[model samples]
Structures are given as C-alpha cells and as structure tokens.
Target: MRFSLLLMVCALCSVSQAALTFILGAHENVCFGVFTDQPRTSISYYFAVQSGGAFDVDYTIKNPRGEVIVTEDKQRQGDFIINADIAGEYELCFSNSMSTYAEKVIDFEIKVENDKNDFKANMPDQPNAKPKAHIENMGKTVDKIDQKLDELLRAIQYYKTRNNRNQATVKSTESRIYYFSIFEVLLMVGMAGLQITVVQLFFKGSRKQLV
Candidate 1:
C-alpha cells in the first residue's frame, strides 16, 4: 500500500503547473527557470499584464543550450508551448524596459508535461490480470478528467486577466475625456471674455472720436 501511495505521489509531481503573480518595476527584467531531465517534453506558458504601461511587456524563452526558442515584444498577453530538445534548465524572461514610470502587474503560468508514450511503456506487463488492466484504464480516464479541469482553470484565469485590462482601459479613457471637456469649456469661456472686451474698447474709442 505504501508503495502504491508513493507511486501516486510521484505521478502527481510529474505533472507540474504553477500560477504566479509579480510586480515588475519600470525598466526591469525578470527571469524564471524550469528544469527537465528528458527531451521531447512539452513546456507551456501563459502570461498577461493586468495593469500599467499600456498593459504590455516583452518576453523571451531560451532553451537549455542558450538558444532562443521564442521572443515577443510589446505584448499584453500570450500563450505558448514548446518542445524541449535537450535535458537542462530553461529560462523564461519578462522585460518592462520600454516603460519609464509605470510598474506592471503580471500574471503568469508554467506547466511541464511528459510524453504519454513513455508513461504507457512504463506500465508493467499484465497479460493475465484483467482486473488490474481495468483499474489502469480507469486511472487513465481520471487523468484525462484532470487535464480537462486544468484547461478550465486556465480559461477562467485568462478571462479574469482580460477583464482587468478592460477595466483599466475604460478608467483611463474616462479620465482623459473628463480632462479634455474641462479644457474645452475653459477655452470657450476665455474666448468669449476676450471678444466682449474687444467690443467694449471699440465702442469707447468711437465715443471719444465723436466727442
């Protein structure tokens, strides 16, 4: 029983996922690392800037051999998946160097998925064990269900990030509109006052000339 429980724990650890939130200062760069021991593994990442500096940032993904796998500039959100070709530490980086004063609120996720074929091959031979085969099939079904649940969670996070970005945009637009309207009203009032003053001076000059 203990061995079975340990196997379960190890299996769970093999499927890794993380959701992280961080504040990036203006003109700052942050990097994260993920290590894998096998090639052909899938690395998935998603990121969104929730607020500040146009909700945009720059990102880069580097492989174990220091080769660039992916790079994007001035992006607000993204989802990416890449296959690891070598077994080592991979670096993922985010940069806010384009922003001079705005600090960014960043939300991101990283997930590492192993090859399914390897998992299937690792199962012991059970040619004469019907009940064990059935249980193994059930376990696979449960894993599929868990994957679906992870997808749902990711979708929810994506929507939440989008909502926050939209709200911030709306608030910024409203503020600009309010300030512009005030400026327009003040300009119109000043023009009217200037016109009235000019008319009064004209009439005074005309009266003096007639006298």
Candidate 2:
C-alpha cells in the first residue's frame, strides 16, 4: 500500500512537470516569447521600439476588448512575470497599433509556473547543454532529487486535505457568528422597548398621583 501511494504521488508530480509552455519569437533570433502552461489562459500584446533603443510593449489583458488594457514599455532580455487576479482566457500580443521594429538578436528565458500541482517541477533554461559534473555525481543527484520530489508530493497532498477541512470549519464558524450577531440585535431592541414602556408608565402614575 505504501509503495502504491508513493507511485501515485510520483505520477502526479511527473504530469505537473510535463505541462506545455508556450513561447513566440518574432524577427529571426530576437527570441521574444512569453511562457504560460495553462491552456485556459491567453494573452495579447503589442510591441514597439522607443527612442532610446529600448522596447515598448502594450498589452490588452485576458478577454481583450480589441483595445489596449495595460502597457509594458522598455523591456529587455529578462523575465516578465504575469500576476493574474482571475483565471480566464488571458492573452499577450506583440506589435499591434505600434511600429514593428526590433533590434539585433536577443535571448530570453521564460518560465511558466503553475500552482495547481503537487510536484515541484523544473524546466532548464538550456536543456541541450553538456552534462554537468561527472556521470557518477549526476546519477547521485538524480536519486536525491527523486527522493525530495516524492516527499514534496506527499506534502502537497497533506496540505490540500488540510485546506479543504479548514474551509469547512471557517464556514461553520462564520454562520455561528452571523446568528449570534442577529440575536444580539434582537436583544438590544427588546431592552429598548422595555425601557421606553417603563418610562411612560412611571410618568403616567406620577401624574395620576398629582391629580
């Protein structure tokens, strides 16, 4: 049973890591690309060159209105991490409503990080490079990484279960709190009504005695 559980965990980790990342480059070796693994998310962007030889990127975010939504100007060979608030068909386009100008070839390393998986996957910037270290060390590192990945996968499962349980607990607590607040309001109204009645009766009795 333990081995089966471990195998299942390993499979889940592998799938998450094998996710596809999309990238696009325009004008030969000027490899301008954005990375995203989620198919449901799409992005559109427009690129233009500035006066100072820097790059300008204007973007219309997910579910674009066929008009510009956001702009990223003067970007150079580095990461452009997109932090999205809601999940949908997010897109990024390059070079629309602007000049299609670019300089010499530039290299880029884009990463598409996902949040819904149990595995801590890795995508090498240059996967075709010569193998590092001796073959013996490479084997050892592979074994160690597999062990760590197994442990991480188990942790992800544990945390996911914990989060679900906590959500239910929070909802129940909130309902109780709401009812308690309503009860408090009703009690205050009843007390106020009683006080007003007592005050009116006291005044009426005093007036009758005086008469």
Candidate 3:
C-alpha cells in the first residue's frame, strides 16, 4: 500500500504543482487556456474564493469550438472533472464583473490526466499474464486512495476559504463599531453643551426680569 501510494504521489506531483493563488480585481475577467494533444483526456478543475465581497465569482468553461461546457454565476467554489474528447484548447475563465469595487482572492487548480502511460497499457499481452491481476488490483487501490485524498484536500480548502471570509467580516464589524462609538460620543457631548447653554439663557432672562 505504501509503495502504491508513493507511486501515485510521484505520478501526480507535476500536475498538482500547477495550482495557483491570485487576486482577481473588480470588474475584471481572467481566462486560462489548457491544450490537450490527445482525445479522451481527463481534465479536472477546482477553484475557491478565499476572500472577497460575498466570497463568490462567475466562472465559465469553454471548449475549442467556443461551446460552453459549464457556466456558473456567484459560486463560492466548485470541483469538476470533464472529458475533453475533442483535441484542442479548453478555456477556463473567472469574472468579477458583478463586484463594482471589491476584489477577490482566488485559488484554483487545473489538471490534465492522460492515459498514455497507464499501467494496463504496459502489461504483457499473454493470455495468462501472472502479474496482471495483481497490478490491476494495486492500481485500483491506489486510485481509491487518490480520490479520498482529493476529497480531503477539497474540504480543507473549503474551510480555509470560509475562515478567511469570516475573519474579514469580523474585522469590518469591529471597525464599524469603533467608528460608531466615536460618533455617539461626539453627539452626546454636543447635546450636553446645548442643554447647558439653554439653561444658562433661561436663568439669565429670569434674573434680568427680577431686577
């Protein structure tokens, strides 16, 4: 199991390293192109809005023919795998146009998995290949472990994004409270001064009438 896991990790490191974190400005759009030379390749896409106004973004996936594969509006995060059966460039785009002033911090990953180096492909063609079944079983186990790891990572990212957005909200609330307290204090002081002035004017008028 350990050996299989290691192999899986080693095989995936290059594609996993393509993950990116960046800021998407307000009213701006960003697109990334991924080209596949072979058909029936698996493409995985994942993204989260780590922090920003509403913690949401609009996204679109388009194929080489300019046809939309998927489109979403105001989504906080998504994970999707699509088969790119047509050999060409696929476009993934993120748009913050709905946000007039708030910018977004986005974390996203795109992975392309091809079957050219599949373990099954390298197996011997003999009808009674002794190690074929063992190898296939090992591969299946490794795949299951890999899928679990992906789910765990996605959960972690989701929590992290929520934490960041919550912290931002808390800080904003604290600031508003601070400024409001100052305004309240100023208003109280002004009211007290006005009351004192009114009392003094009333007493002065009463004394003049008595004289």
Best by TM-score: 1
What lDDT is reached at residue 52 by model 1? 89
lDDT of 1 by residue, 156-201 (tens): 9889988998898899999999999999999999999999999999
lDDT (0 to 1) per candidate: 0.81, 0.40, 0.80
TM-scores for the candidates:
0.85, 0.32, 0.83
Candidate 3, which segments miss by more than 4 Å at Cα?
Answer: 1-17, 115-123, 126-129
In Å, residue 8's CA in model 2 sits off its true spot by: 16
Q: Whose lDDT is greatest here?
A: 1
Model 3: per-residue Cα lDDT over 95-210, one tens digit each:
99999999999998877776635534654688766576787788789889987998898888888887988899999999999999999999999999999999999999999999
Please give the range of 10 consecutive residues that has the lowest summed lDDT in model 1: 1-10
CA RMSD of each candidate after superposition: 6.2, 19.8, 6.8
Query: Residue 163 of candidate 3: its Cα lDDT?
Result: 90
List the candidate numbers ranked by lDDT, top first: 1, 3, 2
RMSD of 1: 6.2
Name the runs in model 2 displaced over 4 angstroms.
Answer: 1-146
TM-score of model 1 relative to the true fold?
0.85
Compared with the true structure, what per-residue lDDT tens digits does model 2 show for residues 72-191? 543422223355333333344333224344332221122233442223234333666655445447757876997597568546644543564466567779999999999999999999
